[model samples]
Target: MAGKSQAGGERIEHPFDPLFNEYSRVLILGSFPSVRSREQNFYYGHPRNRFWKVMATILNCPQPQTVEAKRALILEHHLALWDSVAECEISGSSDSSIRGVRPNDLSIILKKCDIRRIYCNGRKSYDIYRRYIEERTGREAVLLPSTSPANARCGTEELINRWSVITKDLQSQK
Candidate 1:
């Protein structure tokens, strides 16, 4: 279905595209895009999500309001963003109901870049990667608390604190 319309009559071909750089030092995997996120075409673009805010605070970068700025942040910090699932015909955003976890084509990035570490944004993502991708690739990944607004159990400060531990390498490399 090329350029199919959503229930709200908004035209969309697919969710946001995966992003990575040639010299990426780390990869952050999300489970799947929410409907709002799919419409916006960016990761954690939802205002309430606070992922960019947390990352900006942790990395000492300005809050990214636009997709270009977010891409710039990833490029500037050598961070990559993509989901564990490639393209699943799922009904909604709930990861528990996710099926057919067809792994994403990482060859383009893997061939061109040096990926030092893989970080899953949430437990659902990590679980999917463990079952689908990591088993095949033999690549171990570190799991971080989910930054989605849905994961209110882990507050922004806690999320950033956990993320800081993993991203210490990024600071060292700079």
Candidate 2:
């Protein structure tokens, strides 16, 4: 249950959209976007969040400094985005409290694409995916450290280190 925000003087719909396509080789899953993300209408729009920065750095892509550019960067890299839950009853955006979670129909991707890898953006995504859909797909997933600033237990350098593995695959393709 979410209320329309009066901030920014605009109405927002679908605060967080999992970005992905059939051709997408990588999938970035965020638990859910914050109110600010909904208001801005983009993924990881929060300046402090490092998902884009970490991925861009890993891929050696020009760091996307703006929201539109970030979208372009992901598409340019052939990555797809989709939340683990297709629909859920959530109080605010906290992943811990998401209830009645229903996973998005992934058959579209399975039928149309050659998804080489399914990388959950963080542990929450991985946990949900593993419980809800992984067995059905019968594919192993790689759990990347959460890029959310909320996960301050780990340092940025450490996060970058874990993320380098994903980058290495892209480099090897070259």
Candidate 3:
């Protein structure tokens, strides 16, 4: 899907609502949707992103294929998912090329859920959240490595090991 042109570049508006409910206990954030994610209109739509695999391994659930299944995997585990950015100018799906940021208001989810923790899927998301949302919420966000295929140095196993921290908070709430 093509984004709107802005200042001789493409500016994409986040196309989906945050996945969460009153029962959600953990909030997981990404910087913004990738081109593939935007095309599919879901988070981590890229086949090789490894987010679903990591989550499935840590949460001990099957890797979800369909959007509904993914939603179920998140909500059933008391997790919420969203991006830190509401809209931005990006080049193709490159996080390094991202600019013109407008942050999403996380209060919408925070207000409705008893979120015990906030996690950022990558450095970009963590940085964006800290810069834009952390002060308002007065919450610290844990930064996890990027699950994008571009982050090849951190394999699935390594990602799972790092991301297992999510389960700590999830289990504590249970």
Model 1 TM-score, 2 decimals: 0.86
Instruction: For candidate 3, write residues 1-174 as lDDT tens digits.
Output: 346666555887898999999999999999999889988989999998999999999999889999999999999999999999999888888888888889999999999989999999988999999999999999999999999999988998999999999998888788
> Clash number for every model?
0, 6, 0
Better of 2 and 3 by TM-score: 3
Q: What value of lDDT does candidate 3 attain over all alpha carbons? A: 0.91
lDDT (tens digit, per residue) of candidate 1 on 1-174? 223234323222336677887878788888877676877878876688777888888888789888889889888889888888766545556666556556776665667788878889999889988887886666898999988877979988888899886569787766
Number of the top-ranking candidate, with lDDT as the measure? 3
**Which pairs of residues collide in candidate 3?**
none
The lDDT per prediction is 0.76, 0.70, 0.91
* Residue 67, model 1, lDDT: 87
Residues 1-174, candidate 2: write the lDDT tens digits: 343333322222344555656556766666656556766877876777787778887778778887778878877777777667666655555566666667766666766656677778788778988998888888878888888777888777888789888766655544
RMSD of each: 3.7, 4.6, 1.5
Which stretches of model 2 miss by more than 4 angstroms? 1-18
Model 1 error, position 127 (Å): 0.5
